[model samples]
Target: MIYFDNAATTKISENVLEEMMPYLKENYGNASSIYSLGQKSRAAIENSRIKIAEILKIKPSEIYFTSSGSESDNWAIKDILNKKEKNHIISSRIEHPAVLNSLKYVESKGIDVTLLSVDEFGNVNLDELKNSINDKTGLISIMFANNEIGTVEPVYEISKIARENNILFHTDAVQAIGNVKFNLKDLDVDMMSISGHKLGAPKGIGILYIKDGTEINSFIHGGSQERDRRASTENVASIVGIARAISDASENIDENIEYTKDLRDYFLEKLLNVDGIILNGPIENRLPGNINISLKGVKPQTMVRYLDMFDICVSQGSACAAGSIEPSYVLSAIGRSEELALSMIRISLNHNNTKEECDFVFDKILRGMKKFKK
Candidate 1:
């Protein structure tokens, strides 16, 4: 199958899998134990943490592991709210459900939440963000890049705003880890969340970066894992997998970005030849592999299934919200009409895809559109 829905999740790298095999086999001792076998597992976990820390230019103590990006996001937002020091938070309307839902839950508990509006490009208005802060605003959570539309946010500016106001800043960088390059020290955000599955690692591992001395309550309570902050047995194999995967992605990011962007532009040029196809998000600052578009008078689910029949995998919206027959909230936040929102399809790419695959998928899409002509 020619998979175009890489934004949902990517295949695990073969090298990453090979590196993880030992941990899954003879090296299966618990990381929390004190025996030699356990020490081996502990050593692997710490080494992986150090590797990831070096990539982000942060302290190894600052990185905490969780099961997924959703978990990391929930921990960052909920734990801060649990601190009870702030009753107000700010976020964008186009954030992934992980952040949006967490904020919604807190809002139900009488916390004031200001979901800033985005422009037509799904970018948060920095002015609105600046105007929303008050003494009670203790934290600002925004995504580094959008999953559905792929618009990269002004995170450096956002970080500066939060610092100036003494408000904590957290970014869900699940989609930006491999697509956009940034060092944590330069960006200077208090917290950032990353998912291994979005890049080349396995699906059961994620990381949350909390800057040194940043105080937040712990949601998980158990054994002394993750410096006694996140309590659970470590998934040693996946941890090792993610460290290697991220290191490889970081080392070759420039080459990957050029290749994917060029291929995506070529595909868009061919696909937009058809009439009444409206592209979503900004053309210049979007992710290298993201292409979202709307076709009038057609249903996105129908098109998705049609492509799947030809072994071409695509998506209607975020996989987290799949199987819900609703217009995309991200599209709505960006001022798209209900009809256009319901008709949107996302075609995310990766370096593994080729021109021949794009040509095949474009031909199938042309036929599908012709079959459902308005």
Candidate 2:
């Protein structure tokens, strides 16, 4: 299959799998134990933490591994709200469900939340963000890059504003981790969440970076792992795999960017020539790998199934919320009609995608559109 769903998850690289094998087999010791086997596992986890920290330009102590990006996001949001009463949060309308759902739960707890508006291009307004902060504003959670539309937010500026107001800033960087260059120290963000599966690592492992000395309550309670921030035995194998993926991806990010951009641009150019197609998100300032297109008079689900017949894999929206026919709240938030939102299909690329694959997808989609039209 020609997979075009890199935004949802990437195939695990062979190198990462090789790096993880020893831990998954012979070195399968509990990191919390004091025996030599346990020490070996513990040392591996620490080494992975250091590797991830080095990639983000932060101290190793600042990184906390979690089960997934959703878990990390929930921890960051709830931890801050639990620290005090009368909490308020500010987030954009286009964030992943992980952040949005976590905020919804926080709101259910009587905490005030302002779902910030985005412009037509799916970018948060810095002025609105500045206006949203107040004495009770405990946290500001925004995504670094949109998963569906691929619009990159002004995170550095937003974090700076949060710093000026002494409000904690957290970004769900699951989509941005491998696609963009991130420096935790330079961004000044208090917390950031990243998932391994979004890169080339295995699933069920993620990282949450909390800036040094940031006070937040723990969501899990039991063993004293992750420096008392999270209480769970470490997934030693996945941690090592995640580190290897990050290191490998970072080493050649520029090359990947060029390749994916070329593929996206070529595909979009072909699709734009088709009749009654509308492109979503900013034309320029968007993720290099993302191409979200809305076809008139066609359901996205129908198009996805049609493409699947040709062994072309894409997505109608976020994989987390897939199989739900609900009109995407994200597209609606950007002022798209329910029909337009229903017609939206997202095609994301990666380094493994090729020009030939793009050409094949274009031909199949064009033929599929013609068939539907007839």
Candidate 3:
């Protein structure tokens, strides 16, 4: 199968799997326990935390592991809202459903939210983001890179604005972790969320980087896990796998970027000549691994089904919201019409994707278009 759905999730690497095996088998002890086996597990978890912090150039104490990106996002958003009542939230409309849904829930709780609009190229306006913040603004949550369209937001600039306004900033970097360069210290973000599956680690594990001294209330209140911020037994095996994946990805990120960019450009070049094809995001500033396009007159679901028949994998929108059949808010935020949004398909690549697979997908898309034409 030609897999082009890296944005949804990535296949875990063999190295990561190898690193996780011992934890799953003999070292399966609760991290909070005081016994030898538990101490060993706890030590491994702390070491992995340190490694992840090194990779992101942040302090190990600042990193908190979560169940997934959604949980991390929820914790960040809800903590802010709970701590400061009647505060305004600034976020882009193109954010992943995790952030968008969290903001929606916050709004339902009587918190004012400003869903900032993106330009046609899927770029958020810096001025608009700046103007959205006021004394009542508590937090600004934006995505590092768009999952569907691949457009990289000006997160550094937005974070700076948030800092100047004394509002905390958070970014959902789930799709950007392995595909883009990220330095938590360099960016003025107060918190960031990352999912392991998006970076070739096992699913159901994620990281939340909360800058030191950032005030956040507890989400899951039970035990003293995650510094009492979140209460759950740690997924030790998955955490090990995530740390391994992050380390490996960081070491080879430059090569991955170059290789994927070549494949992405080649694929786009082949499809650009096709009739009624519109690229959804900025051509240059977007992620090298992502290519979102709308095929005029063809519904995204139809194209997805056609591709699936050929053993090709792709997505119509964010996998979290796939079954809804609703037009993607990300596309809509970028000024795409409802019909165009419905017709959009995202093709995300990974280091494992080959030139041959790209060619096959191109041919399949062309054939699918011909059938649609008839």
Top model number, lDDT: 1
Report lDDT (Cα) of residue 293, candidate 2.
Answer: 84
Q: After superposition, how far is residue 330 of candidate 1 from its true place, in Å?
A: 0.6
| Displacement of the residue 164 alpha carbon in candidate 3, Å | 1.3
How are the candidates ranked when ordered by TM-score, highest leading?
A: 1, 2, 3
* Residue pairs in collision within model 2: none
Model 2 scores a TM of: 0.98
Predicted candidate 3 versus true structure: per-residue lDDT over 87-113, tens digit per residue: 788888888888888988988988989
Q: Model 1, 1-374: lDDT tens per residue?
A: 99999999999999899999999999999998899999999999999999999999999999999999999999988875575768899999999999999999888887899999999999899999999998889889999999999999999999999999989999999999999988999999999999999998999899999999898877799988888899999999999999999999999999999999999999999888888788999998999999999988888889999999999999988898887788999999999999899889999999999999999999999999988757
Question: Which of candidates 2 and 3 is the stronger one according to lDDT?
Answer: 2
TM-scores, all models, native as reference: 0.99, 0.98, 0.98
Local distance difference test, per candidate? 0.93, 0.90, 0.89
State the lDDT at 255 in candidate 1: 95
What's the residue-level lDDT of 217 in candidate 3? 85
Over 4 Å off in model 1, which ranges? none
Judge candidate 2 at residue 224 and give its lDDT.
Answer: 93
Give the TM-score (vs. native) of candidate 3.
0.98
